[model samples]
Target chain A: MTESTNTPVIVLRGLKKHFGVGDAEQYALDGVDLTINKGEFVTIMGPSGSGKTTLLNVLGLLDTSIEGDYQLEGRAVNTLSKRQLARIRSRQIGFVFQSFNLINRLTVIENVALPLTYKGGLSHIKRLKKASEMLATFHLNEREYFLPYQLSGGQTQRVAIARALVNNPSIILADEPTGNLDSRASHIIMEELSDLHQRGNTIIMVTHNPDLTTYASRVITMLDGKIASDTDSLLGQPSVEFKRPLAMVVRPSTDNQAANSQTKPVVTTLSKVDRRKLKVAVRKRQQIAKNRAPARHAEEYHQ
Target chain B: MSRFLLSSHLQNARHSLRSNRSRTLLTILGIAIGVASITTIMSLGDGASQVVAQQISNLGGNLAIVRPGPSRTNFLTDITVPQGQNYATSTLTDSDVAAISALPHVKEIAPISVINSTITGQHSAPAGTPIVSTTPALSSVDGLQLDVGQFLDSNISQNTAVVGSNLARIIFGTTDALGQTAYIRGYNFTIIGVLKPLNQPINYNNIDFDNAIIIGQDIGRQLSNGSAQIQQINIRSDSAANLTSVVSSINKTLSAQHFGDKDFTVLANSDISQPTSELFYAVVGVTTSIAAISLFVGGIGIMNIMLVSVAERTREIGIRKAIGAHTTDIVWQFLIESLALSLSGGFLGYIAGYGLAFMISTALPFYPSFNWQIAAVSFGLSVLIGTIFGLYPAVRAARKDPIEALRYYS
Candidate 1:
């Protein structure tokens, strides 16, 4: 397909998701505005209760009933029915969970063909054939008949990736794709994801590891249910300095000059002790903010 | 509901069901027992009626049997009254037999007078060995065969008798005792014939001919003090086509002779096949209702197992939903599993039922029959039960929220 470089794939404005009622209410996602373009790999990092996973769920259309104006591919998704959203999820978006959710009873090929089984009109033979071809791309042809437990952690995640892409969805959503893997396995998964990015597939990944963000075209960091900083840097850098920003202003970007100008130079001199102290201080401030909203923090516990 | 998706769902269901082999087998066993009883009961009931029907056809379609009282008797009366004791209050007499014999199309008529008495012939026999007195036409009307000598002659109404094969053996010590003298009610009678052996004891005739003696009608009346009660009469028309006319005329003649009391029943064709009156339907109906209750219990067992299966597979449902399975897909997966369970049970029950039926039939007079209709009904009922019981659990699995489901650990 022919592609425009700056076409907006996802746009969210004033998106708010809250839990509980009245005095016990808490906003998991509070007034978040963001835009993701086609073929751009974005990585999100935040503290435990910062609504990063919730935002990913909303973007994947797995969660609904939120206050928002969200358009996917220029079509308003907030007005779509649950069934229509499911259709969009199956046909246009793919999700990769941290646990590598392959059905334990199914063989590797059958697990990879799980998504195609839900789509109408394809026979089981054809679905398996497609799954076999997808597995061949990952060099997993010999393990087609092996169950999930029989595969190593890296092979299992690769099978999950093959399953997610079996239908050739428009965007891939990975919620800590390497969460359960060791460094070497995580490196291999990151390289496969980068290869997918080089092939023009849009990827939105959630991770706690800072080193993996070097593969992203842009980086977004959230704090206290809101975007604390959004930057277009660290595409291929080895080390970087953290930006301490209090909710940066979000705007529509047609190659915005201000964001490019705010790109801080790489800092390779920061010690591990200094980074640890910065993380500890950030956590202490977050705890104080959570303490100030006593009712909301209590509700978060209930959730 | 696409064909491709249906096949895929079927494969998935098969895989899951096989994984839990013990549970599936136990659940299937419940349905099997229920279906087995139903099949066995149906086969036995149909087999008994088939035997009686075969006997009726063998006697030729031109025959009609007349007995005392109305043809339609209730279940209570049939069970309380022992076979021939119901004939005590019978209104039939020798005149009714004479009146029926005068009909236009009637070829031959034989009135049976059961004289209850003991006999002394070289060696004494049982006390209540019935001495049936009838005309020589009885041999033709009842399709009886003689092993030796001749049947009672109608022209010579003397003290001549024909003994059954078993009665001959009991009183005279041998079936070859053709010239044996038997004393009945203080009158001496010479045995002229020995009947051929008949294996059919449970027949419409209600008489075990193997232990009975046959004498002339005049002797039967003399023994009963000239007030002999005619218990039953068997009439045969010249041709099968003349049966309806002969039966109607006999009914009219008997009604007119008894001053239109209508106390006699003339039965032919379909009515001849009714064994032990209408008790056939009553027994079948009661037992079939019991079988239905068992099937209902079996259905409940299936529902319980399916609910447990759904609970155990909650995380599996979540994983499938996360991978893009719709609500209908999950529902069909479980539904198909239950269907597979019950349908296989039905098939096993069909084979087991026939085996049981054949085993029991060795003691019975008739063999149980096998047909496609019974197989079809067994399978149809199995499908219905599976659908009814599997639906709720399947729907529960389908309605689980994908987000909550994916987070489930078990």
Candidate 2:
């Protein structure tokens, strides 16, 4: 609930799910604890029957019989009604499935704009424009009029990603997004996810391939309905390294100005430049932030 | 849940129907046939009744026909004369006719003796011409007007006869048959008169006047070796106002003469027409029932196909439910689809039914005219059948589990 930079985007405490009752009961998810923070690309890796799907379903609000506390953006999700759950799912969660789940009868753009169509407060022209923009972002502008069956696996996944981004969701929950693609297609999809994560969008993907974890900032390994290992930096350190020279220079100036008077002019000039730059940066940041905020928050979980 | 999703469902249904065009057409054909049969039978039955009623009303109001039985029970069994009793036993006699004439409010009583006798003349009469023997009062009771010559006299001093216009045509080939001799069973009788042409053949007793040769009652009995008996007594009331009183007095007199056995019956116009009306209604009832069965079968076919459709679209149902569709909306969608099919079919069937009824009326001699009331009823019944049968399938579709349904493929 505190306004902390490390506040978890998703948190689950002591989650337990049983499929049946008494002797016939099957434990799908048992006593699981996990937390994912903002801007972190987390991949859940497990073999079949490890309850990866069950855990994903519980997080998505698609299934609600588990005994646990689920907090999304610091709000309890367990007590929400089905209608409220649907609203949360549509407004806050984006989903990319292994099978691409795009309605075959709808054109690519229509499939992407499906959530917006159901929400129905926007003008048709505006929704279409937004859908086109999302498609254009994924280099799928040419395939907008094509149905799901007309697109290649890679192209379909791109469209699915565009659909996820169309509603401007907060987090993307992908279940084996690259499972159905060839190696070349799989790499292209992972590259897109990595780029999206670097853009400050949080992603929680479930995959059986360990090689796919190279793209994630953190990897949570599951075994026998439990977390076996929470591996951070499975591929490398989190790709949050500052690339701009001004941001790098400003970081050293903060410490140097406090230490010596001889460096005052340099500090002052840099500070003035930093101030002007900060204003420009702040304005630029605000614009980019406004542009990207919706996509970041729109993703919840998809089954 | 959402208008977009609902529209999507309709789109899906349309697509499915189009994809399986032959199957869809077959189903529609099945329902159409059911609708058409029900509509045709009910409409035709109603039309027939109306036509019969109309024909009955065309006959004169004053005409009263008495048959051999007291009441029309089983006409073949109760009225057919036995071999031994045929000569001596008389149900209606000449004395009874005189008594009916003497009653108050009675205008005339014409005693008629009918026999299936062959006739011969200069020109041959048509085969199966009835030989009728009656008094001069027969013309007044029957409301008959002479076409050319006078009716028979009170006394049968000579062998003179009065013939129906059609019979006169056959015997003499022209209305100038006055004083022509017409032979009846080898006995020569002069045709002194010819009656006017009555377009309708006699219906009650199955007698045809177009081929009849009429003579004096005394002369007829003499020709039959004194075994000729009066089959019916034709009575005429003085006025429409005196009908009820005249019928009552005749019943009382006939009952007294028959030793309080009530072997003879006296009927007014309305009473005589009751059985015919009831017969018409019975036919309508039977045909309507048959039509109802076809409608029921059609409704069942709709329900069966709808159930299959719901199963096929299980995934779609789940998706809608997950998106927040209520149970009632799902039910309404399926129910509306069924009602649309049935009502459209009913409208077409109603038009077809009336067309068939019209054709029947023109093609068949005794077929009835079309009735709109029956058409309306058939239409309503088709809709009711749709609603009743569509309910369970709609409910089944509505109550499906979202999770399980979502998992279904194909």
Best by DockQ: 1
TM-score per candidate for chain A alone: 0.77, 0.75
lDDT score, candidate 2, position B143: 60
Taking the tens digit of each residue's C-alpha lDDT, what string does model 1 give over B348-406? Answer: 87888888889988988689877777888789989998999889989999998777878
Error of 1 at A209 (Å): 3.1
The C-alpha stretches of model 1 lying farther than 4 A from their native spots are A1-36, A61-86, A218-303, B61-142, B148-164, B167-194, B202-294
Indicate the docking level reached by candidate 2. Answer: incorrect
lDDT by residue (tens digit), candidate 1, A49-161: 88899899889887778898999999998788866776787788888889998889899999989888886668888999999999987778888999999988888998899
- Please compute DockQ, using alpha carbons, for every candidate against the native two-chain complex: 0.40, 0.10
Worst 10 residues of 2 chain B by lDDT: B77-86
lDDT, candidate 1, at B165:
94
